[model samples]
Target chain A: MNDRTTVSPSARTTIRRLPELANHDRAMLYSIVDEAYVCHIAFAANQDTHCIPTAHWRKDDYLYIHGSNGSRLIKALSAGAQASVAVTLLDGLVLAKSAFSHSMNYRSTVVYGQFEVVQDSAEKLAALDVFMDKIAAGRNHEARPGNSKEINATSVLRISLAEAAVKVSDSLPSDKDEDLDLAVWTGILPLKTTRGMPIHAESGEHIAVPDYVKNWAD
Target chain B: MNDRTTVSPSARTTIRRLPELANHDRAMLYSIVDEAYVCHIAFAANQDTHCIPTAHWRKDDYLYIHGSNGSRLIKALSAGAQASVAVTLLDGLVLAKSAFSHSMNYRSTVVYGQFEVVQDSAEKLAALDVFMDKIAAGRNHEARPGNSKEINATSVLRISLAEAAVKVSDSLPSDKDEDLDLAVWTGILPLKTTRGMPIHAESGEHIAVPDYVKNWAD
Candidate 1:
């Protein structure tokens, strides 16, 4: 973890709507990015704006994503196109007495910057290992490591997390004073992403379940 | 539901990477949009691209979103700016014997279009009702409806779902023949968004829990 405690929002990263929900603490940004399995990235290509979802991982103060060398997203970002990435985790639904006051509880972060291509082979391999570790701890060492040919076919890119904005809404329902006395049911309906029992592949059923898989649902 | 069976993919909506994983079925597109609580919208404004997450809902052939009239997203899209919207649902992590073969099972859809503002007051109100129903079936009737002033402050915009692409990845792990004998525990680790117990607001604890809240987790 870095010693930085806060992020300096860029012109585009500043939150204008409901600024009270904006958070600047660097740890909050890291946690939001770390907990999410995928992030939606927006970039312009061929004079068109595109939003695409892909797996993401964090290493130090940078967010990393990998894709085939010929992919449109990789080609566009590697060319130094300005991009915005968003990761949102819906925590719950806040039902207020007033329809206009209804809201959602969520933790979301948006990062703005140009992606830099990871050109060094060693750095690229280490980054991929970090991504694999994110998927399943200790499995990276056990799985067949990527061969030169496989690694060569992929392109890894990283963007700094300095210019980012975090917004978290975890409060209970807040209705207008006049609507508070209404007889409608007001509450929070919590939502969480949970893991289910692991299913072993047909060829690997004889292998023992790893600690990561065993503790996944817990 | 409309009788439309498929979406005609435009040049921008065509899935070039992993084309076989793409589905043109209109029902698949609707199901993906209907099941998602939020979508990431990508649009270019002020010479920079932005990807932001916002609550969304579908009614008939259009996906709708509402925001404060002054919000950046609402303003940018209402100006006829081209946009791309993506909704992604991650189902599981696919672990394979080889690190390079690791994949994710997901249902994702991307729509490319320009959002048009809902000008009619009655139409906007009815669209918001559909959104409320998605949050809770009968809560719209019980909650204090939005007054004229509140309704006027909100901007509702809808984008046609005709130019959309659906991609569903539900296959098992597939590793190379040479790596099949590897001893790694390969399988699927499922992930699902689940509802937790309802939490009543302090002022409304006396009210009975609605059936939607009661059956949320089930």
Candidate 2:
């Protein structure tokens, strides 16, 4: 049997159960990770645990998680040498008249794997390039390269998509007949989270928006 | 020790971990559920697994989950009679030079509990009201009530916050002695997710904009 997991809550909205919901395949993996700007990563560290939501970009079957050497997520994975990463995207809200009838539609993923630090000089350079391209599409070559000082302090953790799942729920509310006439209003109030136009960093003085930056997805 | 359940992909972002990471205390539970608008629920049914994301709201001690009578979540929980739920909020992105050194700052919670259909008619009504006020901040009284027909078609499930854990991480990248001077753009691209303006939902045309609606929270 597949080692299936469950996400239960005091509310049913948090517990999604669609058959088409769990996407463990490769194609679905890339699509889910590429569309969003932010992802909430849940990882196990020490005897304790933590979930860190941060900016991320995917390259093939590997997801790159970054942090200062001081950050908990990085420290946990680097020290314990094993981790679980999860990312979710919220699309919109689904409303139903009965208080118990409201819900939302969204896309989410959770990955389990042992992360390995990138150390090879050329491989490290490639990993950095992929990260830039994944986040900004083509910004890697267009933007200035990181100086030696900046590269030394940064750390990147790579989680191979060895075991994972993609789950999505997209349906309007289904209210009942008797409760229909109750005074509460019901309908979807959709929510979309996206990045705004590139606001050149203050340090980007005089540098025109690179074509790579302009071409990045929303 | 609290019961430890596995959170699989079938339920979306729901994950299972040790007791330390899966706490269900008062202060720990309220903040995680309160601060989030959506959640990832994991469950199992027909001997398979799944997880999905949906909107949610909370009551005093119990959380209210609404869905179509045919929802996969309700179907599974009502069957196996239990599940897991998780919500995570992404705060920012930490970009570092090395691919493995990147990370993020965020807060998240995982709750494991048995799911029961809210059978009490009176309590279901109250739960719906709380949901309305929670979202629109007083729109419940202003909006029209639901007819009986609406309530009958939807299913509401209730689960206790008997077990859960909350984790939050925030930190910046380190400009190591060598990588610090790489000239590449370095630093965090801060991120925040919040509710936007009141759409003055078409149904609310008669109500006009109430002060509560005008001053909503993030």
Candidate 3:
């Protein structure tokens, strides 16, 4: 059963040093998760831990991550091992007055839960649709439909966002009083992820760029 | 002692499912590690796993990660729990004819090791300088120097890139013959992280943007 408990900062998720930056608002959690296309899924296997980066998407309350049925991590997760998923969007470089104070402005979310494999064919299809649309609008309909073999060969794991933690560090760089007069430039060098000009595939060169793909931006 | 063993596909670092895409070349590993600014660190703490995103920089064969001395993860690492650090750079989106064939073009590296605290003040200061230049060139010399207290307050964990896994996926989308003729746009929507115009702090607005920060790019 999916846990629907309200997310409270447990000893695990609490931001100890900078407690003010911890956020538990549901909207903020959803926004941070929605703004990214990739996540790192970490799990313990063979007496060691590994974090695998993969594509991810969010629906109402569940975060869906799909991978090949043969993936070891997928098999391990399906066996009920708890997984930790993290998504991070680096916003900018915070340049402070002192080297010790330099930091990055970023928004990140960490979700910890046991993933249940989506076995129902219909649910799997719907999850696939959500994944495609999350990556690009109108992509599922535009692309060839998923066949039964394809659906069966894929493993879709669903995790509830009930025990999630969201942390945001967007404050301007602060300096010590004594360092303020130092002859250094102090400001933010904002970093942005932008969509560049599309490059057509070998056979797709003659195909016109679809408006959905052309106008897509993060 | 830092582990200098050759990077092999051990049980933890092996790319089992997609073995063809695995890369272990030292130069390729260094290149992938050098190109990114942020990494997601995953570790098991308090019976739950957490993957926190933080800025990272590589020097020679060691990867340095610093955080507040009171951070739970840092404390756990110092106490001798191994960490799994993953850095992913999204190069483009692969739009394919079939949903199952769609994938992202990216370069990522995963390093697994226990971190040792850099207790020597000189080594710690030099590591901090390397970090500053990695983020923004000339940032360290331009900024106010770190005092002894500040140096003591920070925890810099050094992990040798001994057992690491690097994966680069730059392939164009390939689909089944029947699905290739589908009327879908098949191409790459390249994603790039670029620097935006600098925004100065309140008192630093009058200072000219330095050439080092101005030319910084990832």
Estimate TM-scores for all models.
0.97, 0.59, 0.93
**Which TM-score value belongs to model 3?**
0.93
Model 2 lDDT tens row, A78-142: 76444445567676555555544555667777665466777665666677777666654555554
Task: Say which candidate scores most in lDDT.
Answer: 1
True contacts kept of each: 0.89, 0.06, 0.78
Task: Score chain B of each candidate by TM-score.
Answer: 0.96, 0.77, 0.91
Query: What C-alpha lDDT, on a 0 to 100 scale, does residue A126 get in candidate 2?
Result: 76
Segments in model 1 whose C-alpha atoms lie over 4 Å from true places: A1-3, A203-205, B1-3, B203-206
**Which should have the higher lDDT, number 1 or number 3?**
1
What's the C-alpha lDDT at position A111 in model 2? 67
Instruction: Name the 10 consecutive residues with the lowest summed lDDT in model 3 chain B.
Output: B1-10
Flag clash pairs in model 1. none
Model 2, B36-139: lDDT tens per residue? 78776655444333444556788866666787778766777666444667777765555554444445556676666676888776777778777777666766
lDDT of each: 0.92, 0.58, 0.82
Residue B158 local lDDT, model 2 = 70
lDDT against true structure, model 1:
0.92
